[model samples]
Target: MRYSRILEIVGDIVKVHVPATENKQTAICFGDLALIESIADSARPPHLSQVILLEGEEVSLQVFSGTKGLSTHSVVRFLGRSMEVTFSPNILGRAFSGTGRAIDGGPQLNDEPSIEIDGPTVNPARRVLASHMIRTDVPMIDVFNCLVESQKIPIFSVAGEPYNQLLAQIGTHADADIVVFGGMGLIFDDYYFFRKAFEDAGVLARTVMFVHQGSDPVVEGLLVPDMALAVAERFAVEEGKRVLVLLTDMTAYADALKEVGISMEHVPSNRGYIGDLYSQLARRYEKACDYRGAGSVTILSVTTMPGDDVTHPVPDNTGYITEGQFYLHDGVIDPFGSLSRLKQHVIGKVTREDHSQIMNTMVRFYAAAQDAQQKQAMSFELSEYDHRLLKFGELFQRDFMDINVTMPLEDALDRCWQVLAECFSRDELLMKDSLVEKYFPTPADTLSQVDP
Candidate 1:
């Protein structure tokens, strides 16, 4: 059905007045797509839009291409459907805009089957417990906080941090069958970096990106996550492929929501964001799931906190919805701030027997190392134990905490033993005697090994 009159033009939103039907039902529902065409100028191309708000006899649509050339004398044609994206094997190795159109300059996917985006999440009864781990070859993650399959977690950081580089590293090394990436408000340099990283690592063939550059319309950024998750859900269910979805800078997404909400004259909540901020974010994060009989979708997103404040609305709300978070700061994943609520499920079951003990002992010693360093800074006379702790701390940061250090899980565990042996005796470990005897390095063994 086509409505001829536009009531208001505010930002990218165009309000149209639609007459009630005989039954007095809504003429158009929210989320439905519409095409807005200028009535006086037929030469202008129609702008694609989505119904964002609906009131009595009035419908508001968000123009994906902005409302610059639009006027009040425009026609709104409802499509009777929500947003959708193409889904097929061909999407692999391709890049798309937030609107689901090809932006990689490759062939269009018009022939592929189009699947509706933002569908309902999987039923709780149909979900399986997340038990398997997704190895990223980063010891800080693989050893300390395992990325359990189907877990939804975020890298909490501030602006100017290496969060994007960490994300790119994970995307390149993660042991998932397919990777679906959503980049919101990314600059051209960052976008090119991700593409080049994947291409150089030879993982682009199994990767798909849906990007909304910084210059794109704000409304488009809101669609990037939905489009990426929609395709990931399809691949997990239909093809039985374990899909890893990476979304960077979700703060940009929330900001986009705030912009649209303000344009619509809605009442603001915290920090001038819409009242349903938590619900809006939960709707996306809850999409991470492990199907009962099929594959799974693990979501790893980046949420930058303003001013490094954990109390910021974006990161605060995300913390509640996600399983846990990786606190990335100073180019390293902070062991104390990072936690994986599901790591217990896989630490011992899927990994080495000493995995759990090594994790606990390493963090405990690192904590003591921090204390020792504080004492040294205070100009207090350091004890012999403190001296050993200081050495261990340096090695810990250099070997495991460094973001650039890459090693397999077993090799990382072995390196942990080597470092411990160099600092303290076997009895100092306080781990299980069985594990200590089996994996602990002896003096002769330590002497035989050369420093890398």
Candidate 2:
């Protein structure tokens, strides 16, 4: 409904005083659109802004770009609603900017009507427990740290790392019904790489990207997540499609949030960020859940810490919100730090019989190897056991832990056997006798592989 402009130039925020007295509501939600026109310049285009606050009849709108050039006598029209994003089958095989604008040079989409962003949360009663596994066909993820469906997790990395490559690879390989790509504050090259990679891998047919590049409006970074997730939820619930959402550089998104919060003069909680940081993170994460009888929405995001500092406000707050995180260092997934909290739910149960035993034994020996390295660095005596541990650690890191060593789960487990046998005698493994007899190599075979 159209209303008379009440007050303008209210210190960077335009206040449209209209009687919501007829329509009773608590607060005007984020992403709600408001059209403002300059009364003096009647022919001027409408200054599109979104509702920032609602106090009875007083509703404040934050201009998408800024409130510059907005005068005191501007006509304000509140749509009494938020910005709506279009989602449909046509979204597949297409790419969009952070604001839901087409960027792939594709034709316009007009089939499915759009739904507003900042969608409602899934009812607890309608949410099923997250136990199903979502495999990305990446050894670092599948064999060691399992990714469960509907789980919200982040890849903690640093700048100049291969986090984007990893995310692109997951898009190409993850076994999901649909893929939603949300790129926040991405460079133009990074954005293009995603489009090209998906198209090349043949997954673009099922992928939808919402990008907020470095050159675009900063506010779009905050909108990208909500828009992607809202569409994902609809597909999961309405069409029963398992949607995998990949968001890159969430730290950028957090910074954008902080920027807007500062603009509003909101009080800072931790590190000058808005105090509701945790809740905001949780609200988005909680959206990553499986519907009771429908499809699932799984979230895998990248959170690059400032200077690789996990204790920074963005990653620090995120650590508490996500189920677990994958730590990427030096272009490889670190086994010592990367963790999947729900791994036990799928590991050893759905994976091979040797999965649990091998995963455990590999990490255990690698730890011993780290100790051996320390001792060796300090010129300590290398005990016979220490020598063996050192060799095993080298082999483990080179074989199983190397990011370039791409192999299936069974092959990885078989390689684990090769390492275990090379380092110890049948009697030294401390494994079950029955299993040792089945897996451990004979003396003759050991001499053949382990040359003196």
Candidate 3:
């Protein structure tokens, strides 16, 4: 049904007066789509909008294209549906705007199947235990924090860190069958970098991107995650494809929510964000699931903490919803700050026998190395073991901790054994005697492996 009276035009929100009716057919539900048409100027194109707020005889819609060209006299036609995105095999290798319109200049997907966005998450009974791992060939992730299938985790980093590059690396090398990426408030260069990275790695054929640029309408940024997750859910359930969804800079997404909330005159909560921030975020992260008899959807998102403050509302709330987080700092994944709660599920079950032993030993030595370096910095006396620890620390950061280093999990495990042998004796490892005897390098081999 069409309502001719637009009550107010504030920013991108257009409030329309729809009289209350007893009939259920014409009831305006929140999140329903609307078409805003200019009555005086028929030549102007109609703008698509979504109902964000509904009160007695008053309905407010957020226009996707902005409200600069809209007037209070514009007609609002309710579409009786929420937002949706096109879904098909052809959607792979394609890029779409936040509003689900093709922006890559490729053929339009108007004929493809359309699926509704922001639906309820999978039921707990329908989900299976996440026992499988999604290898990204990055030792810090594969070796230390094993990313399990259907896990939802975020990369917590501040601006200026190479979080996007890390995300691109994961997207290119992740073992999942499909990658669905959502970029919120990304600049042109960052967006181009992701596109080129996927194309160069030859993964573009199996990837799909839904992006909202920094200059786009703020309301559009709020839709990118929903659109990307909707497609991922369909692929995992219907096609039985293991889908990995990557969203970058969720802080920008949360900021967009704050902006919309203020525009709608809603009372702000902590840090000027909306009151339902947790609910808004959990609705998306909870979408990660491994279907009992089908495939899975694993979400890895980036949430940049403003001013490097973990207490910031965006990262703070995100920390509660996600299973664990990878703390990215100084261009490396900080071993001490990062945690993967589900790594125990796959450490020895799916990986090499020495996986658990090597992981524990390597991190233990790295911590000692950090302490030894602190002593050296203070100009205190350093013991021979401290000297060995310093050497091990340097090699650890250069070989395994470096984000650019990529290798198979087994090779990484072997490298860990080699590094430990180079720094400390067999007894120093404190690992299982059987594992050390089988995997630890011999004294002669360690000497030969050492660089001259």
Candidate 4:
């Protein structure tokens, strides 16, 4: 039986108060998908599109574009389910729009199981320990602060910094078997760069992309990540593949959600965002899971601080939901403010023997050097130790901490030892005696240093 169209609205929401019969009552709820077809002025043109969403009996359909030409009595059909993403090996290397529909003009992926987007998260009790490591070839990340598999982390950067380049580089270099790239509110340049670079790197075969450009309906941005993750979860759990999910500018994603929440006239919370801000973010981040019986999803998300204010609601709420954050500043990862809470999980277990010890010693002295720099700037009388610390901090920043300092983990740690020896004696550095003897260069040993 066809349903009758009852009312219409302008903002992508169509009201369909269906007439009911004894045993043929309508069974539709909010968030179920609905197909809408509209014919305006019958002679001019007709608008047709797939199910967008169902709110009560009123099916709110995104009319591809908006309902600019839609009129009353336009036909609507309920799909009886929500929008779903196609999950299969074929989905990799393909690009889709926010609605899980292909944008690259490729053949439709109809073979994979169609699972609902934004499905229930993994059970907390069933989630396995995040023990494996995801090696990103970037030295500042892999060596200094390791990214653990199944870890949910965000890079906090300003708008002008190279966070996009960093994300693309990681996608090109990550050791994961599969990568799901989700871009929310990307401009044309950024969207094109990812496609070109991934193709050139030959990693495009194992990757999937879902993009929502700036001009697309803002609602698409909110759904892009969920669409990507829906496919990723299926790939990981079924194929036992290590998957890395990369998301750029999640702030735009959140803002898109907040915009919809505002359109619905929901009550405001902190910073004028909807009250469910934290829950919305957690729903996406919680998708980063390592299935005990199969594979995993490790999330590396980008959350840009508006006006460089970390206290902005978008990032402030993200900091709470994610495992930890990579605080990017001035085109480099700021060691002083940046931290990886799960760095300890993999430092000694998955990495080299001296990784944990070297990481501990380097950050500790780097802190001391910061204080020495402050003293010098204030014109305080500098002591011998202060002078040495000043030199150590400068060298640390120029060598290990900068993003351009790309090297393997072992080389980065050996460089750390060289930086330490130039400023302080082996005993004063206060490391494990055995580790020092094994890894640290002796007085007679020749070690390379950053030429001052």
Candidate closest to the true structure, highest lDDT: 1
| Candidate 4 TM-score over all chains jointly | 0.90
What's the lDDT for residue 248 in model 3?
92
**Shift of residue 98 alpha carbon in model 4, Å:** 1.0
The pairs that clash in candidate 4 are: 34-51
Clash totals, every prediction: 0, 1, 0, 1
TM-score of each: 0.98, 0.89, 0.98, 0.90
Model 3 regions more than 4 Å off: 447-452
lDDT-superior candidate, 2 or 4 = 2
Alpha-carbon error at 304 in model 3, in Å? 0.5
**1-452 per-residue lDDT for model 2 (tens digits):** 56565665544467777766643543345557878887777877787788877777777777755566677667777676788789778888888877687888988775668987787787867778777888776777887788898889999999998999999988888889999999999999999999999999999999999999998767778889998999899999999999999998888988887877777778888888888888888888789988888999999999998899999998998999898999998888998899999888878677777678777877777888999999999999999999999999888777766565556667667667777888877666666677667766676766676421
Q: Which ten residues in a row have the lowest lDDT in candidate 3?
A: 19-28
Question: Model-by-model lDDT, in order?
Answer: 0.94, 0.82, 0.92, 0.80
Pairs in clash, predicted candidate 3: none
Higher-lDDT candidate of 1 and 4: 1
Candidate 4 C-alpha lDDT tens digits along 1-452: 34556475646445565644411455665566655555445554443333444444444454444566666766666666766788877888999887777888798777767888868999989999888888876767887778998999999998999999889888988889999999998998999999988999899999999998888877777778888888888889888999999998899988876776565556878877889888888999999999998999999999999899999998998989888888888888877677778888888887889888888788889899999999999999999999999999988888866665566676777777877888898888788998888887766554434353
Each prediction's RMSD over C-alphas, in Å, is: 1.3, 3.4, 1.4, 2.9
Candidate 3: what lDDT?
Answer: 0.92
- Residue 6, candidate 1: Cα error in Å is 0.4
- Candidate 3 per-residue lDDT over residues 75-122, each given as its tens digit: 988888899999999999999999988988899999998999969998
Over 4 Å off, model 2? 1-13, 19-31, 38-45, 439-452
Ranking by lDDT: 1, 3, 2, 4
